[model samples]
Structures are given as C-alpha cells and as structure tokens.
Target: MALAKPSGLYPCTRSLPQAKTRSFPSLLQPKLHPSPNPSLKPFDATPGLSLVSSSAPVLHLRPRRGFRAPPRASSDPSPLEESPQKDATSEYGLLRRATLVGTATVASKILGLLREIVLAAVIGVGPVATAFNHAAVLPRFSSSFLGGVNGPIHITVATTLSKLSKESRRQLTRKMLNIMFLIGGAFSALTYIYADEIISLTAPGLQVLAQGNLIREMAMNQLKLMTPCILVSGSMAVGFGCLTSEGENTYLALSPSITSIAVIASCAVYILMKGSSSSSLNSPLLGVFISSGASVGSLMQWIIQVMIHKNSERETKFISWMDFFNDKDVHKLFALMLPATLSSGLVQITSLTDLYFSSFIPGAAAGLSYAHLLTMAPLGIFSSTLILPLLPTFSRHTKPSSLASLKENLQKAIVLCMVIILPITCTSCVLAGPVISLLFQRFKFDSSASSFVSSLLLCYSIGSPLWIVRELCAVVFYSLGDGNCPLLINLIAIFMNGILDWLSLSVFGLGAQGLALSTSCVSALSVLALLLLLSNKLGGIINIRDMRGPFLLLLICCAISGFTAMFSYRMLQFFLSTISILRLFGLTELLSILLAGILGMSAFYLPLVFAKFAGVFLVDSLWTTLLNR
Candidate 1:
C-alpha cells in the first residue's frame, strides 16, 4: 500500500512508497552463487550463518545457534539498553580505584606510626608533649571528624554530588568550597583569638599542677599556631569530597602522609639544632616548632587540593561572594553539617572530658594518646580492609524481602570481627609492657613512661573488639537510614563517660588507669545497648544461642594464646639476660616481643587448623565462611 504525503501544516512529514519484502537469509533459502565484485566473496559469510545476495544488492544471513544478526541499515533509531561491556569497564575501574585507595591508606598509616614514634623519641612524655597533646585535642578531633576524608563535609559532598548531573555537581562543589572557606576562616580567627581561654577550658586540671602555669602558656601558644589548620582542613575536606565523586582518591588518601612527613622533618631539625650540648631548650620554644610544622603541613595539604581543583576542567573561582551567600546547595550543605557536627561533637566531648581529668596526672594525656595510637593501628587495618567491604552487602540486603539475609550477614560480620580481633587483643594485653618498651622507650622516653603507658594500652586493648563492634553496628544503622538511633546512643554515652571519668578519679582513685577502664566499661555497655536496639528493630538479627559456642571457642583460643605469649616472653627475657650481648640497644626487648608474638599467633591459628582437619566444623568453618565473604 502507498502512503499519503503530508499536508501544509505537517510539512516535516514525507510521502512513503510501498516497500519490497526484505527476507532474511535462512537455512531453507538457497545460497547465492559467487559475484564478480571484489567486495562480494563467499568466504565473507560468518560461521554458522549463510549469506545471500542478489542483483538489487541486498546482503542477508541465515540465523543460526550462537550467532547474532547485525542490525539492518535503517532510518529508525535503536532502543537504549544496558551494556555488559560498559558494566565490565566500570567494575574494572572501581577495582583499580579501590586498589589505589587501599595502597595510599596503608602508606598514610605507616607514616602516622612513624610520626608517633618520632614524637615519642624527640619529646618523650614530658611537659612539652603533654601540653601539645592538650592543645591538639580540639584541632585534631575537628579536622579528623568534621573536615577529614569520610568526615561530615566529605560525606555530604560525596553524597550530594553523586545525585547531581555534571554541571550541577560543578556548581554545588563550587558553592560548597566557597562556603567552607568562609566558615573555616571565621573559625580560625575565633580559635586564634580565644586560644588562651580555650586551653584553660579544655584542661582545667592543669591549674592544679606545680608547672601548670608554664604548661598552660605552651598550650595557648601551640593552639594559636594550629588555629589556621582548622581553616585549611575544611577546604581540604571539600576538595576530598570532590575527588571522591570523580573517583580520584589517590591524593585524597595519601595527602595525610605529607603532614606526618612535615612533622617528622620538624622533629629531626629540632633534634639536630639542639644537639646534645644544648639539651635544655625552652619547652615553649619546642612547642612552637612542632606546632609550626603541623600548621605548615595543613597549609600544604590545602594548597595541593587547590592546585588539583584549579587544574580540573570544572574549576570555579576560589572565593565567589554570590555562591557563598546565595547558593541553595551551599546552604543545604551547611544545614546537613549541623547534625553531623552535633553527633561528632558529642564523641569529641567525651575525649576532652578524659583529657580534662588526665591533666592533673602530669603526662597522662601523652600516655593516653600514645596508647590510643597503638590500639588503633591494627584495628584501623582490619576496619579499612575487611569490614568496609560489608557496607555494599548491607545496602543490598536492606529490602524487606532480604531481611533474613541481612540478619545472617550481620551475625557473620560480628563473628568474623571477633575471630580476627580477639587474638590481637589478647596478645596485646599480654605483651603490653614489652610492646610499649620496644616501640617508645628510647633516648627521652624512659622505663617509667613505658610502664605508665603500658597500663593504658592494656586497658584500651580490652575494649578494642567492642570498638570494632560499635563501628559495625553504626554502619548497619546508617545503612538502615536510622542514624538518629546511634546519635542518641552516643549522646547518652558521653554523659556516662563523664560520670565514669569523675568516679575513677574521686571514688576509685584509679587515676589514668581508671579513665581507660571507664572507657572500656562504657564501650561494653554501649555495644550491648546497640545490639539490643538492633535486635528489636529487626525482630532479632542474631541468635545468641547459635553464636554462644563459637564465641566461647574464640575466647578460649585467645586466652590460650595470651598465656603462651606471656610465658614465651618470660623465658626469652630470662635467656637473653644470661647472654648479655643481645641486650645491647633494646635488641633483647625487640627479639622477645617478635618471637613471642609469632608463637602466640601460631598457638591461636594452629588450634583452628587442627579443628578444621579433625572435622570439628563449628568455629573453624564459620570463620572460614566469613573470611571467604
């Protein structure tokens, strides 16, 4: 049938003629004989399909198993669909990004450890170290939680940016960057101006100490130097958020190492300048040098972030007045920040509470800081590498239909966290003295300091697993869109922590050890509360009866490892004393810790291996299942 032409009102439409039948080549159709044209060849036929061509010059093919026909030339467009090749490419890109992030994260952690060791060597647990720790409490906490990678600002930026189009993302990012700068500048100025009062408020116990006035002065000076870092950190966080959205995480992960390097260089320079001949440098002067390094490091991070942003194709003006005041997204970002700040602020308050209590105990602040660094190193590795992978799994299983699967995953994650952490916790608890002695007991850091910090480390290690559990539970709550629950729980925990801090000092007379113990106790209670709430929310996520056996076995294995490591250390230390030569330069301490640690790990894992081989599949197989996940 012929089609009619368009009317004047529909001028774009054209007339159509009757179309000829375009039959696809089939097995039933006879193949055309060869043509003399150079482009036409019999061998050009695809395997499993026969080609046919005629005088009018149409190419056709027979449909066969495992063969797809090419699309016929036409004026019509093909419908859009997802492409497997594109998915594969995206997955490959994601894998590459994860690898880069993981590597840089590990490097940053290593440098962080180096920074701690260097600080311990350079300053020891002296007045300078104590004052510096006090001054850094607020800056470090704010920069890390409010402005660091994965912080409130970073998360908000990444989340909001992901939902926007390219142009919208650029606009949102520009507005956010400008607003952060303004807010950060205001904060820096305020902190600098009020540094003295801030220090006094942060560590009131300092007033009671014999050298309290001197320490206070140093702290105020250090706080002022570090004030500008608050500003730089806020802007850097926004930059990190932008990089994260673009999947360029290498610099975001590694930039922290730069700060550690700068601090280390500063310490080295201080050591060289002082030389042993002038070992009595003024504490306040030393504080200035270290604080200056930190400030410079932070500035360098922001500079690099700015350079990266400028080099980007979507770069915007650095300080846009219009965006700062008029942008809705900028306002939205700050609005989002309020809740995040409150939630994180509660946690920091608890830490400051401990600092306030520890100030009267001389080097308690420094000791706590060092012990915390040690406790977090291993936990950080596990959290970043293993537990973080579970977020997507949690997200996927959030549907009502997959509630059972979510519950099962939660159980597995808890058990796996225990399996991996319990051994490390027990080992650390048993070898706290040797570990601290080997790591930090050096030129300035003495036996007394190691003994003091070892107690704190032991106390901190007991609650280490609980810490991981709390993080996991928080992750689950966040995945479920119930972040308020955790926030409320943390608010209660802060009050509880304050009460415990006071009780430890006034009631128990436990001093710094009491503070650490109070933290552990609070952690245990918090985990129990979170679990109970989680169970109620999900109609019970874990079966206590089902997990009792595995949990018991893990505890037993960890306990045995602890005893074995302690005994090994005792025997090794005694043997080293008989040799005398191995005692040179802390070799005896290092060797004992290393050898005992190996044996302890062996004792822990060997039992599990034997259980698997002997067909005792309860604990061993469950852990293996989690590991495979």
Candidate 2:
C-alpha cells in the first residue's frame, strides 16, 4: 500500500522538508507473489481485501547510507515507526536462506548427536541421566506446548502474528514471552520443591533406589539443581520463537549445535578430570554438573538470537510487563496455549509414561534412556530441523497454491528419516549386543544394560517415522489455525497409550520393550488421526488412495526383509566365533535385506511401471475381503 501519508500541511522550507536530501538507498522490497485466497468462494463479492495486496512494505536492509525516506517528524505514524520489518520467509526464498538456516540446522543435529553419545558413555542411564533428561526436556516441553507448532495455541499465534502489524506483533510477542516465562518459573519452583515426589510420579519404578529420607532428599536436591533451566531456557526460547516470527531463523537453527558442543566439551573435560567410576555420587554427579553446562550453552544461543533479532529490526522496543497483562493478545494467547499445551503436552507425558513402564524392572530406567537416546537422535535431527524451519513457510501461505510442495517435502523428509534410521533400527534388532558394546560398553553399562538398552532402542525406532508424520499433520492443523484437532488426537493417544502400556507390561511381559512398543503404537495412532482429521480440513490435499498399491508393496518388502535379516543373522552367527560371527552376520544380513527389498519393490513397481495395478490385485482383494471391517 506504500502507506498513505498522514494528514498534514507542513512548513516545508522554514524547517527542513522530511524528503529533501534524506538518504535514499535502494531498499529492495520483498519479492512477493499474489497469494490468491482459495478458502473463500471467488464468486462472492469481497469488496475489502481484494483491493489490498497480502504483501506489506518489507524494508530490506542494504549496506548503504540507510533508506532515503520521506522522513516525517516524531509525528509520523506510530505503527511503522515501532514495528519489525515485514519480510515473508517463503518456500520461494528457501535457497536464499539455505546458508543462514539450513546449514545451521544441519550443524545443530550433528552436535546433538555428540551430546547424546557423551551422555551415554559418561552417565550410563543412572539417576543423573534421568535428572538431566527431565531438566533438559523442561524448556523443550514449554516451547512445544506454548509456542511450538504442534500445540493448539500455535493456530492462534500463527494467525495473530500473520495478521497483525509489526508494532501489534511485537506487542503480543513481548506479552507472550513474559507470561510464559513466569509460568516456566512457577513450574521450575514446583520441580525443585517437590523434586522427589515429581520423580516418583514420573518414574514409579525408579523410586526403589532411595531408602528412608535419603531418596526424597536426593531427588529434591537433583530437582532443585535442574529447576532453573526450565525458567532460563524456556524464557529464552520465547525470544527464539519471536525471532522466528520476525523471519530470523538461522540463529535459532544453529543454537542446538552450539548447546550440544558446550555440553560435549565440558563433559569431555569432566570425564578426563574425574575419571569414569560410579562407586560414589561424585563421578556421576560430575556428569550431571557437565550436563548442566547445556544451560550455559543455551545462554549462548539466547545471546545470539537476541543480537540477530535486534539487528534485524531496529524499531523493536521493550514492552512493559504491566501493560502486557492488560492486552487482549495476552488473554487470547493463554486461551490458545492451554489447549495447545494439552495436545503437545500429552506427547511429552508419553515420556513420563515411558519412564513409568521403564522403571518397573532393574536397569529398566537406564535402558530406556539409552534407547531414547537413539530414538530422539533421528527425531531431533530431521523432524526438529524441518518442523520449526517450515512453520514460517506455512504461516506465509494463505492460498491453496500447491500441496505438492509440502507433500514433496514430507515425502523427502520421511524417506530421509527412514534411510538414515533404517540401518540403526536393523542393527538394534540384530546387532544389539555389538552396537551397545561399541557405544556404551565403558563405565557402568554392563552386559545386562547392553541387552535391555538394545531391545528398547529397536522398539523405540519403530515409532520414529510415525512421530515425524504426526508432527507434519500437526503443522498442517496449526497452519490452518485449528489447534483443537491435534489436541483431540493427542488426547486419544494418551488414553490408548495408557491402556496399551498396561497390557504390554502385564499380558506381554515386554518390560521396557513393552513401554517402547506402546509408545510406537500410540504414535502411529496419533499420526493416523492427524492425517484423517487434517485431510478433511485442508480439503484433501493428501492422496492416500493414490499410494495404496505402492504402500502395500512396501509392506510386503518390509515383511520379507525382516525375515531375511533374522534368518541370515542366525545362520551367520552359528558358523563363526562370537566376534567374527557379528561381522559375518552383519554382512549376510545386509545382503539378504537388499535382495528381499528388491523383490518387494519389483512386486509393486513392476506392475506400475507396466501400467498394471492388477499385479497387486490378488493381495488387495485378500486385504479387502479378510482385513476390511
């Protein structure tokens, strides 16, 4: 709109004309496309918005003597004066941002891996591991449930931030950050105050380690030690989220790697200085202390984000805490936040359920942690990389332009996750002993720990893809500004998981593996719910029916490959020594897996390649007749 000049008749030459000699740098505006609104009927007479373009006046900062502007006095419009530059981060601009954000996210995931490996080797799934996991998860949970895309509150935030001016936008951002920080602080105190009680509730099985008052006291002390992270990291993440809204993503994307690097470096020094002994609390506690170093790492991240946000937007100013509370944006945020929290929070609670099921047996808690380390690795690497980065992409999209972009992105993301993770999953199933030995053989990770941890790792891997799919669906719902759907889906999963976990433990006697299995099942169900629910809302951008033949073929391939891997591993194992057998078994397993996979592909694709769905008709008929309800 080039915003019309405010009503005025100024003394031009008497003072100095605002436009005269004012620096005029070529402020290349955002390359915006006309996003046609597909949600509304074209025939409807919409007199208002059609005259106005969706794109705003994006002030692209050039390395020049600032912009030559018709500089008005302090009497200028307050909105433009106090707002962040309105630059839309779009899929069209993905390449431009590749170095800044894409590279940074890649770095973060790599660092996260180093962090997990160090934790497993040094901490070995003890109380310290459990404590650190809870502490670290606190901020992440707060971020997800509050401003994260998966939560219901995300819809409101996305819509509000998308619709509002830079000034109004900052108004809400500051308010939301302050309110969430206070809530995080309260949670922090609760975590610290009743740390022992919270731990017991969270991990009933792990409570066996304490005697008399020692247990309670130890849990409380650990909780207190970890509590501040909830406030510090959680509050910092709010700024990160706002920066995201402000179109500055690289700083946050690279922050995880920085945090992990700090933890890894500190832990390496701790391991060298303290040595790897678990006879007393001091050794393990050193790891805990080093783990706390991540908070410091997070601080570095916060500093970077704040600097980037400030540099990106010069008009931003501090928001008053009192004035923030009175704003309608604050009230609307919690309204959105509570339900969104319920949805995303349910997913977080699954970890607690995992803890509950994992603690029932000796070494179960630690074993689950090791398994979770593996599970979270790929998830954190890819899904976290994609979800947050793509959220702004979705926010800018108000049209039904092409689900192809998102579909392709999802397919590639899923395939990438599967490709990177399939080998790990196979190894967990077959080379559990060797893999655990290679990773956590040192310190307190004994033979039993290795076996149980490997089992849990395999079980948890089953849900990894499902988790990503659910995340994608949640993003769709959030982008559409409907948070209740994902929340409802999660609510169902929570109910299903609790039931499934109990049955898995009591009926199947699967122990930690059962907990992992239940999680996998619940996650799959959640993904299904999200797909079904969002398909209806987005008016069927996804074509599940189109992939029916290929999907069946993939399933057939998976089953065949599973059996081949198992049989090949066994045959190879029988013919060699334990050490030599693992190597041979791995080789034969890979060969058999490849062969079976090819057969499955041929079974489905050969027909499609030749334009014949009939090739899989027999299987489809059987599935429809026998499996159809």
Candidate 3:
C-alpha cells in the first residue's frame, strides 16, 4: 500500500512497489467563516472560540440528511465567475479529528503490515516478487497521479469545491466525474496495450538475468491485469475529494485498509488452492492473482464512495456532452490539474527513477519495496492525521491580515512533525533489523532477506523527516494557491535526483541503499528550496533563527531516546539467554522489541512533556487516552 502523503490523507504514492503501489496523499483545508449575507453563512466554530487558529476549517460533524441546496436563480453566477473572500473557522479543534484519524489509520497500518507479512510468506523477495513489483510500478503510478487520494484531481476538486456554493459544487462534481471517466478509460486502454514496453523501460535489468525473459513476461501480464485500477481510481479520487471537502475524514482514513485486506485474501485463496509448498507458491501466476485482487479492491473503493455520495445530498450525476462543453468550471479544474499533478506526483516519478536504477541490481527492486513498507507506516498515519485537516484553514486565511496567524499555525504543524517523526526515525534506524525481522521473517521470507531489507530500511529512515517536511512545505504553497512554486522545484529536484542516483550507485556503489540515500538528499534540497521560496512569497513569515532552539532540543531528545531503546533491547537480548523461562518459551525477540519500544517512547515523550512545547498537547492527549484505557 502507498503511504499517505505528509499532507494528511492516504497517499498511494508511498503504497506498494511490490504491487507497484502508487498512492496520492490526502489534503484538507480549514473551515470557512460565515458569509456576510444571511443566506450564505458558512459553517462556524462555537461562538467566540476557535481551534488553533482563527482560520481553522470548520468540520460538518453531523451528517445532514436530505440536505437541499438553495434553489438556483436565473442570475446564479457560474462557479468559475465567483470570487468570494474565503475565510475558515473550526468549531472543533484538530485534536478530536486527529484522534479519530489516528485510531483508524493505526489500525489500517497494522492490517497493511499483516498484508505485507502474508505476501512475504507466499512470494518471498525472490525473482517472482521482484517481477511483480516492477510490473505494478506503472499502473500504480498512473492511478495515484491521476485519481488517487490527495493526487492532483483530488486536490483540485477539494480545493475548488470548498469555495463553491452547494448547488455549484453538486453540478461541478457531476461534470468532473464524467470527464474523469473518459480520461481514465482511455489511459487504462493505452497502459494495457503497452504493458510490455512499459515493463521493459521500468525493469530493463530483467533482460540481463538468466530468467529475465520469464520474469519480464510475468510482469507484463500483471500490468495488463492491473490496468483497470487506474480507471477505477480516477473516479475514486473524485469521491474522496468530495467526501474530504465535506469533512468525511474518518472514511478516507479507513478506506485504504480495504485494499490491503483484498490483497491478503487473494493470497490466502491462492495458498489454499495451490497448497502451501514453497515451489507451488512460487509460480508466476500468483502475481497475476495479486494484481486481480488489487483491481477488485480499486473497484470496491469507487463503488463504496459512489454509494456514500449518493446518500449525501451532493450526489454526482452524469452530465450531457453539451453541458460538459459549456461548463467553465470544467476548464478551470483542468487548468489546476497540470501543475498540481506534477507537484503532487513527483514522489512517484522519483520512485520510478529509483526503480529504473534498481533494475540493474539483483533483488534490489524487491528489497526497496520491502524496506519502504515499514518506513511509510508512521508517515501515512501521523502526517495524514495531523496535517490533512489544515489545508482549508490555510486556504481561508491567505490574506495579509491573517498572515501572522497562518505563520504561527504553520510553525506549530512543522514542530509537531519534527517532535513525532524525529524520535520515531531515530528509534527505527537503531532498531531496523529487529523491526524488519519481527514483521517479515517467516515462511518464504528468510533470514538473509531480512538482513538485506534492514539496510535499505535504515537508509529510508534517515530521510523520513525530510519527506514529511517537504510535503508540509509544499502544502503551504498549495494552500496559498501557488502550485507553480512546488512544480518548478520538483522539476529541478528530479534532475538532481537522477544525478545523485548515478553518483550513489555508479560512483559510490551504495547499491539499493544508494537509491534511498539519493531520495533523502533530493528531498532535503526540495524542502530547503520550498522554505526559502515560501519565505520570499510570505514576506519572511518563517525564520530559521526562531526555530533553532526547538530544533536543537528535539535532536537532543531523539538522540537520548535512540540510545535508551538500543540499550534496553540489547540488555533484554542478553538477559533472554540467561532466563530459562523466557528461553524455553521462545519469547526473547518479541519481549525485547516490546520493552525497548515502550521505553524508547517514554524517553522521547517525557522530555517534551516537561519542555512545555506546542507538541506537548499531542503527547498529553495520547498519554491521557492510554492511561484512561
């Protein structure tokens, strides 16, 4: 599965490379202030109180039944012609939604982990697995770029819909859905027909191997089977954008787990039918089965979203060809799609670049896939939960008068990402081997594979914070209605990434680790560029000097947590050998990881709790919930 983007929604971009997982991250903006016209009052926060900022997006907590839009007048303005001053205010704070998102997301992630484990047991990181991963890259990339949650389509829809009247939103959505259907259909056909050529470019190294042709054929077949996913995903994104704009984050957070479940079920069925012998399970046909499962999952997502929309008053209808031609909103949506697609989709494109390089290295493609699965878990959960709710808020407060409040909220968001992600990164880097082994060291997944994936995971972890920061910064630009800045920066980053990939693999000889390393380096550059440009655009809204103290404190705290966890794990491992009860029961590895993780978390949180930083609120809430439970 793709890890949701740091922007706070499910991003298929980080999804599967093994399944060629490509995902779009989610984007949410803040609540809007009441319109001066009595008939046009927007959703509001409770009287005289706001959450985090005056510009936070208002969430529609209660689902309205039979909600009807105001009747259209003869003089009703075209959505494209409307230019209202948008300002958002949240009745509810981020904490409540964050809690809901966190619970659903964490559960989803756990299920995703289980899916990966099942895949490893059935396929291992062998040639078949590598081929499947390679084949999946193209379709997943296309789906995520075009129709995945938080992809350009979703962003454009969510951003645009939030600013429109109910009647306009309903009409616009219908037209958009119809257009996406045609585009997605044509794209799917092209992908299906060109499967061989696509696989050749993405996994050229397969041709050089002894069984290269065999692997290549398998991948081509899998790609053809999965092509329909792109078609279904496009419409799915429109649904997600609609739901997200209406503040239906709970479903958005929960939806991805369905994909994982479908994949797992497919594997279970295959194992049952073919028998569980390693040789029987290694057939290329299993990969095809997995691809079919992914397609089914995509279709299910679209269907469920359609059902949900039909229930909502904002149900979409098929627009006539003439209406499609006449609507200016359709033209406007397409205009936003181009820059947003490039900017939001660079992560997948970058992965394709990395995959092209990886094709030359044996087992490298599969290794990268396995490693990324672990690295993306926390990012998908925390980032989507924390940041996704702020997009509307940012959109509403872009005026000069609200600049200071916007800056403060942005700073708070960045600080929270650092406080949470940094500690987890440190802990993961120190405990990479254990985490990898604990998750995927059974059946067909051997000890050697675990060791290989561990190194890649460590490299991927080093850049986790960079990924979060870059996406967070990008969202700020997007909220400011400046997609061009991120688009331009990403274009530059891609070239830089290619050069670094060449240097890391061809020159430094880092192998698969080199791919992850190059990615981190490129993200760091992008993050810096985004911040500097954002500063220029916002009149120095953010200052490096002001953040230095908090940054340093976080780094120190993370270091301490890492060391403490490492020490605890090692000590536990040592004691496990001497304790007859534990050794006899075979609880050594499990207990060691458990205790170490708990201690590490405690070490990280206690200091920040004492520090009285803004991040403390999150910690305090989580701790309170755990204690009460």
On TM-score, the leading prediction is: 3
- Ranking of all predicted structures according to TM-score, beginning with the best and ending with the worst: 3, 1, 2
Q: Which residues of candidate 2, in runs, are more than 4 Å off?
A: 1-102, 130-140, 143-159, 209-217, 278-284, 314-322, 398-434, 541-544, 556-629
lDDT of 1 by residue, 23-114 (tens): 31110122233332343222332222211111112223233456443464677343211121211112122223344465677788899999
Instruction: Work out how many backbone clashes candidate 1 has.
Output: 0
- Candidate 2, residues 1-629: lDDT per residue as tens digits? 11121111111112211221111111111222222333322121111110011121321222224424344578655533212232122212332343345456667766776666677777666655555554444544543344333234444464457556888777676666656667777887777676666765665654565431333344445556555556654455556656666666666566667667877888877767766666543344664566467556656665665676567563235567678767887676666556666777787777767666655565565577667766766565455445655666565453565343444344433433443344445434554555566667666556666777877877887777677667767766666556788888777777788888899889988777888888888888887777777656655544555445445644554454455555555655455334665475555444434443444334433433243222132223223433332
Q: List the residue pairs that clash in candidate 1.
A: none
Please identify which of the two predictions, 2 or 3, would achieve the higher TM-score against the true structure. Answer: 3
**Candidate 1, after superposition: displacement of residue 298 in Å?**
1.3
lDDT rank, highest first?
3, 1, 2
- Per-residue error for 334 in candidate 2, Å, reads 3.5
Q: Write the per-residue lDDT of candidate 3 for residues 1-629, one digit (tens) a residue.
A: 11111211111111111111111111111323322245532223232211222222323322135544466586955432212112222223555566676788888889888988988888888878888899888667765546765566676677777677778888888777777788889989999888889898878888898778888999999999898788877777777777767767778777778878999989988888998887877798799889988888777877888888788865666778899778888777767766887776776778888999988888888889889889988887876676556666665557776665567567667756776788788889889999889888988889999999999999888878877777767767766677898899988888888999999988999888999888888888888888889878876645555456656767778888999999999998998868889889878888998888878867987766565444555455544644544
List where candidate 1 sits over 4 angstroms from the true fold: 1-100, 163-167, 245-247, 277-282, 312-336, 386-415, 479-481, 535-540, 575-586, 610-629
Tell me how far candidate 1 lies from the true structure as C-alpha RMSD in angstroms. Answer: 14.9
Top candidate by lDDT: 3
